[model samples]
Target: MKLHAGSNILLNLLVAVAVSLVVNFSYLLLLLVDQKNDPAPPPPPEEVLRKAERLQCGALHVSPDGHGYLLYSGGDSIYVPMQRIRRLGLRDGDSLVAEVSVTHVPLAHPVMGKVLRRNGAEFDYGSLFKRPAESVVLTLQLIYYVLISFILLSILTPVRFRYSRRRFIVRCVWCLVAAAGLYFVALVTEWRTGRLVFNFMTPRMLDYVLLLKCSFAVVVSMLYGWVYVLIMQQQAVAMENEQLKNEYLTTRYNMLVGQINPHFFFNSLNSLSMLVREKHHDKALTYIDQLSYTFRYIIQNGQNTLIPLGEELDFIQAYGYLFKIRYADKLFFDVDVPEEFRTWLLPALSLQPLVGNAVKHNAITTVRPLHIAIRVRDGYLEVANPKAPKLETEPSTGIGLENLRSRVHLITGREIVVVDTDTEFIVRVPLQNPAL
Candidate 1:
């Protein structure tokens, strides 16, 4: 599963912290070994130590009242008299380490004991160079490792995996190269600073140690990145599948709508031919004009999946005019859709098929006139007609009803409700709000 953005960030931070702790812990262990192997020399004379203590060899801080100094040790603070101190060049919060006398006598002065060994924050470049205190070294190491881990995670985590063997191999090689390059840079920095940053290994074994460390860091980073990439790829595949499904539905709807146009065209021409043969030239001309207007509406909206209810109703008026011209007073449509619901959208060409179906299956005469009602009620656009099915009529293919159902469901996500009884046949189409 894909992780939330905040979760991912937190996880990455945890990984960096873990890596930094491990690296710094290992370095501290190595530093202990180095100290054991290379011991410090013997202490200086008592007079010299006393003079050094008075000179403030360690970091010095003036008391808040400015009457005394506070010398900071690794885990302790030593109070010293301000008057006794001399040549003290230290500042507040500066890192320093000092060795003081382990005395048997109780002192009267604020000086804990005379300073024997002293080290400062300055970098020593001599042959027997002095190193910074353990606390400073460890803190720097932790900061360096945490920064490196964060950089590696940011660089690697967003890379998408390509499913090719050659690309995979290339990526592995690139990671190795990058790791080696970073290791080399670290080595150069440590050498320039004359600091033994990592394990105190012999020159012959140091290369292997650095390589192993770098390789482990790179591998962990790549593994984290690969897991993220897998989740992202899965989401991408799902999105593509959804898009293809929608496209298939669109194409299928267009095919259904395409079927309606040809069927409607043939029927309209038949009606037009009847009007021409009956010696009603003026009526036939008007029928042709109405037919053109209806066809124009269909052609303009044929590719659309949904259109406003008012627009479809206007198209229906033009279509119904052609049929009225043919049947005279025998066919009629009663539309009572409210003005408020006119802006609601519905599947294109939805109503015309139902009207055509009713006319196709019913018998229209002056005595038993056909009445189709189009109205809105309870969030539905209902097209209902009085049942007058003929006994001798062309066989019903049932494509029109099926097409209407599929198109309505695909576009509006609602089914067209059909009700058939002895007296009436009704289709309740669910209305849709395009703005919503």
Candidate 2:
């Protein structure tokens, strides 16, 4: 029922950083208005040609009074306004190539007009101001949007108790609100002119950059919301599938414990009954002990998923003794397992089916004794026995072996390797590596 990863600090941080990288903020210029502070636009060609007659090229001189004058080679100079000087941060001894116009003042030099070039570089009045570089602007913008995104995510997390259309719509609306709020930010930080100046008289027009940022914000919100929901939903599905598989395994294990093979039970009973009738008192009591142990082991372990390899081996030894009594000197088992690997885990009752299959299909006699070997190799528990064909082969649906294989797959997500040859048959069951 867990829904949202909003509490995941790492995921939230990553989303904020990604949004910052994707969002573009430099386009704020086209969204908000700014004061008409930059120099006027260039005149038409005919007006420029007429103005060129009075255009002069000279070195700039700043007087003590903060006024500017362009000094030519012939010592002639023209007056430059103080306001323009302050705006462009004009200094003394600059190469000022400028245009001029006459004034109606008494004996005043012609007033300096728009600057054509400064130090051989053409610059508009706004461009003359030392504005921040594009990278610098982008970086500041990234930081700003990163903070915004984090705050938004914290307030209306993508996933909370559960997904709701109202909540999703609210998140979308919040993104738009955040985006619209950028207009105020642009008002303060004029893109083309002064940055962070807080001028309200600036003019704004249709800008693709502002449109782009708004669109990106809304889209990011939608995408993040859906992705988070999808991830949570997927995890929920996996958990349900695991639960269903466990239920199926439970049913199978119940059958394993509740239903013993009818033929084997009757045969064991007949053998015990015969021993009792023959007055083999000690043998009969020992057979009953072994039979009880075998049933107890199966019932105890049937519902379990896995047990230590050593424990199953103990169970197997007891189980094998039951058959040894029935076919004395005709069936033998050689179990060779290292102590270090005894603690490794295997599916419960895994060996039961394999042992049953071998005994069922194979012939056992005083001459051709069936030898079942249990050993561990390469992190696998291998049970191998020589193929002994009986005079009459037993009818088998193979459901026992197939069920064991399916159970292993369900519990451990692994497959059992079965090898069948003319001379021998082997089943290799993978074990869980033991912990230190």
Candidate 3:
């Protein structure tokens, strides 16, 4: 089943908790069996008993045989008779405080103590670590479980996501082999260090139990690893989809920009024909020179996704020259970008389209001249033109502005800002440092 990110986190936590419970349950079973086979040490040494007896009503545990009990105080356990069980009724598995006394007694009835109060389970964790070597071994076992779990989650999980079905199966098999190898190493270490000795089970039975525990841990690790792998796979698929969408948008924008070139060439040729018919030979020569320069710039850089702002400006100036010759004193173009920001990056041919759009949609005559200005402000390149909407003109395809906006968004993840008013129209393209 597919799970959300939150559910994945919850599942991971649950797995950890389950692993802990399993380990603790196995240890508890081992502890019970060990206690059953070995009798409690005969009433601690005399000096130890004396020290224990001086302490006030401390913890007590009922004997497994139910014939007697052990009273624990000051880090010592003193055997006590059942008769001394006083104000609080005695029972197996009940923790309580009792007054204890040291004395020589018969084997049939050794303890001599009085029960004072029942205090439920003593919760004395220190008692579990009474033997220094056993405590160290237990600590090492805990560390081993934690380390194995972490490696399975952090390392194997990613590997599963990165491989195919056949490879993943092979990886899983290898992981199991590694886990078994590590378990064997741990067993050898414990055995060599004399930490595997158990009073309850025979050595064969002990080996079988250890094997069972290790097998359970390995299985749990694999299960949790699969869940993590599933999560990683889902995230990877999502990222891939996003990248594909961005590529589609970029291609669409480029196609739209490509359409502008044909229409621009047709308009420039019409202007050139007019100049030739009017017998303006010198003006026609200048127009041809400017047109060639502009076309060369476009041809050289049109395929590039981005170019330096200064280069784009140079292309725009050459393009503006063609329009100036066509309209004479009726059209004007001004550029005021800062020198420091000239090296900033921008989409190629981004500004020329805006200039062409202004001339196409607005009437340019001596009675009412058209003015276009390009400048930089507030980390954006501003292209502002005075509005003079044509009453009778072909409807706009809107491809120019849309293409510019899409390219800007795809490249920088930022939108181009447009502001239109009755008197003026402005487009703001965000500037980006080339070094970044």
Which prediction has the highest lDDT against the true structure?
2
Report the C-alpha lDDT of model 3 over 203-278, residue by residue, as the tens digit. 4433665576667777787776766666667767887888898788767766866887897899999999999999
Candidate 3: give the clashing pairs: 80-111, 81-111
**Per-model TM-score on C-alpha atoms:** 0.69, 0.57, 0.59
Question: Using TM-score as the measure, which candidate wins?
Answer: 1
Q: Which 10-residue span in candidate 3 carries the lowest summed lDDT?
A: 122-131
| TM-score, ranked from best to worst | 1, 3, 2
CA RMSD (A), model 3: 12.6
> Judged by lDDT against the true structure, how good is candidate 3?
0.70
lDDT of 2: 0.75
Q: What C-alpha lDDT, on a 0 to 100 scale, does residue 405 get in candidate 2?
A: 82
Per-candidate clashes come to 0, 6, 2
Root-mean-square deviation of Cα positions for candidate 1 versus the true structure, in angstroms: 11.5
Better structure of 2 and 3 per TM-score: 3
**TM-score for candidate 1, residues paired by index:** 0.69
Please provide, for model 1 over 105-197, each residue's C-alpha lDDT reduced to its tens digit, 9 standing for 90 to 100.
Answer: 686334534333345333233323344566666777577666666667655553444544455456656666766556655531244435554
Clashing pairs in 2: 33-202, 33-203, 33-204, 34-202, 34-203, 35-202
Steric clash count of candidate 3: 2
The residue pairs that clash in candidate 1, if any, are none
| RMSD for each of the candidates | 11.5, 8.4, 12.6
